[model samples]
Target: MLTINNLSVHYGGIHALKGINLEVPQNKIVTLIGANGAGKSSTLKSIMGLAKASGGSIKFNGEDIVNKPTTNMVSKGLVLVPEGRRVFSNLTVEENLFLGAYLRKNKEEITKDLNWVYELFPRLKERVWQKAGTLSGGEQQMLAVGRALMSKPKLLMMDEPSLGLAPLIVKDIFGIIKEIHRNGMTILLIEQNAKAALEVADYGYVLETGSITLEGPGKELMVNDEVQKAYLGEHK
Candidate 1:
């Protein structure tokens, strides 16, 4: 559903991404797992047009999307949950969700999508009128994912959905990610938590220092000697 070719990004003199090629197929979960500073988030930012690409191209549904306005992205079926679950602090949960569907004029369909999001996250349902700023970190993350789903994206790119959460909450988040994929939402996941990301991904890429060093089936990468040693904390 999404294709990236020879993608590169730079910040001043720092090269954040280095000629990385990646793809996300329809109805599948693809993950990029790496350490901090590996440029995983940069890839997502580039796709969203939040970050400029120094070189290469990004395509969505076979059309070149490089350098398009971020506003144009949602209409073209692209959405990002973004890093850090950046929810609107003063907005009610319900209001935050509605903002996601602001571009759509069909009220009935928006309501239906809202109901689906609430069902997917019963916690958000319980806090419908509550302000997002008061929510816990895990709940905020759920709200971020829920808000993105409100856009009805064809491909969802999430940046570190599991970051800084408790282990149980991280597990819950990954479970929901799998459920979303099972429901036929294509996902491009960027995760520093390699084990959780790979466990649920159909395919995985190992990125290091702005370049992808390995790509394989998620399970295969999970067992790769280098992946084991580096990300999974295993030694042979």
Candidate 2:
């Protein structure tokens, strides 16, 4: 449902992304796995128009959206959860979720999605009135995902959903991602946790120094020698 071709991004003279070509099929989870400075997050940001693309195209469901403003992308059913789970700290969990649907005209649909979010994340429902900043790291991440779901997006781009959490919590988050995918949300996942990400992803891409180095079915990539050596911590 999303296609990025010959994508490149530069910060003044520093090149952050160099010719990243990737695609996420509809209703499937696709992961971009790489180490730090590999331009994984930059690819997601470029899709949301948060990062200015210096070259090439970003297409969402066949529409060119390379340089579309972030809000426009949101309106077009493309939303990013971002790397840090940047929730509104001072807002209550419910308020944060409400803000996510602010652009929608269909109040009933928003209410339905909110109920679904609550059902999917009972913790968020329990802390509905609590300030987002007061939630634990895991809870905050749930809130972030719940808030994004409130947007009712066709494609959800999440950058590092399990960045800094306990192993158990990371598992919980990935489980939720699988649940989200099962519910028919197309996902473009950027993660450093290659093993876990690939386990849940339908397809995977490996990026190095801003370019795609390998692409294949997730299971295939997980067992490949190069991927095992570079990402899976396995010796040849």
Candidate 3:
């Protein structure tokens, strides 16, 4: 449902992204797997208008959204759960979630979405009145995803959801990701954990030094020699 073509981004003469092209089809999870400085996050940021695109087009369901404001993008059903779970530290869990629906006017629908988030994340419900900063890392990440879901996204873009967590927690997070996708949310995932990312995605792309190096079905890329050598820690 989202298409990025010839996308480029520059940070004061430093070329961060170079004419990269990718797509996320409806109801599918598309992942971008890469190492640090590979422009994976920049691609998501540019799509959300957090990073200025120097050239090319970002289209959402056929219309060009390259020049749209971040708020406009969110209102348009394109939402990003950024690399770090940037939750409102001082706000209560409920308050933080409510902020996601700041642009909406329908009280009943907002309440319905809130309950849906709570059902998907029972921990957030238990800590509804607790300050977001007090939650554990896993809880905070759940809160981040829950908050994003409150916005009722058509396409959800998540950057590094598994970062800095215990292995068990990572598994839980990826499980939730799969659950989200199964429930019909289109996802564009950026992850350094290539193996886990590919396992959950329907399609995958490998980005290196600001350009796409490979693209294929997720399972195909998972078993690829180059992918195995570089990202999956396998040696022939």
Put down candidate 2 lDDT per residue, 26-126, tens digits, no spaces. Answer: 99999999999999888888899999999999888899999888999999999889888999999999999999998998988989999999998999999
Q: How far out, in Å, is residue 200 in model 1? A: 0.7
Give the clashing residue pairs of candidate 2, or none. none
TM-score for all models, in order of appearance: 0.98, 0.98, 0.98
Can you write out model 1's per-residue Cα lDDT over 64-89, one digit (the tens) per residue?
99989999998998999989999998
Q: After superposition, how far is residue 53 of candidate 2 from its true place, in Å?
A: 0.2
- Which pairs of residues collide in model 1? none
Name model 2 segments beyond 4 Å from true. none
Give lDDT tens digits, candidate 3, residues 50-119.
9999999999999999967899999999999988899999999999999988888999999999998988
Cα lDDT for residue 4, model 1? 94
Q: Each candidate's lDDT (Cα)?
A: 0.94, 0.92, 0.94
